[model samples]
Target: MTTATIAKPWYREFWPWFLMAGPFLAMVGCFITIYFAFTQFSNQPIQEEGLVKRGLVIEQQGAGAARQAAVQSKP
Candidate 1:
């Protein structure tokens, strides 16, 4: 005697769709991230007041050091 068994089509199976879900969701998330990145931020430069203050402080320190060196050199 001989026996035969019938198999279901690939689309009706469970594991193939399960395996595909990861990359599909990842692609969706990637597009969402790209959309938000372009829409949520501005193209203008940031304000520079903090940097200007820092530069002024550095210049004052250099001048103070030079004045101290001049006083020490005069015996």
Candidate 2:
């Protein structure tokens, strides 16, 4: 009688690397996102248009609240 044994490398199997790739890529993506988030910030002053945009937003919010109050007061 003869017996034979086969030795296989771990990376030759599909499942282990497949399972690992997801979190490995996710961690890489996380680090990239964090790097961009931290490094991309700037201290430049807001443009004049941005201030006007904020004022318009505030006006719209006040108008919406007044409309809501008027509707609620009716019934």
Candidate 3:
């Protein structure tokens, strides 16, 4: 005796939705990240002069440390 087997539709299946949820959530997160990137950070202005001053301060501190190291090595 042979029996008939019934198959469920693709949308009614659990595995397809479970597998698709990963990429679907990833795409949603990607869109949110892009929106924040353009809206939150793109409006900020760069401070070139402040960056230059910070670089000069760091260089001077490095030179001061080098001078101290040289003085200690001389003895």
Off by over 4 Å in 2: 1-5, 42-75
Query: What does candidate 3's lDDT look like per residue over 3-63, in tens digits?
Result: 9899989999999999999999999999999999999977655445333233235222455
Measured by lDDT, the strongest candidate is 3
Clashing pairs in 2: none
Candidate 2: Cα lDDT at 33: 92
* Leading candidate by TM-score: 3
TM per prediction: 0.53, 0.47, 0.57
Clashes of 3: 0
Off by over 4 Å in 1: 42-75
In model 3, which runs have C-alpha deviations exceeding 4 angstroms?
A: 45-75
lDDT tens readout by residue for model 1, 1-75: 877778999999999999999999999999999998778844433335333233225222445677899999999
Residue 12: error of model 2 in Å?
A: 2.0
Instruction: List per-prediction Cα lDDT, in the order shown.
Output: 0.71, 0.70, 0.75
Winner on TM-score (2 vs 3)? 3
The digit string of per-residue lDDT tens for model 2 on 19-46 reads 9999999999999998986788433333
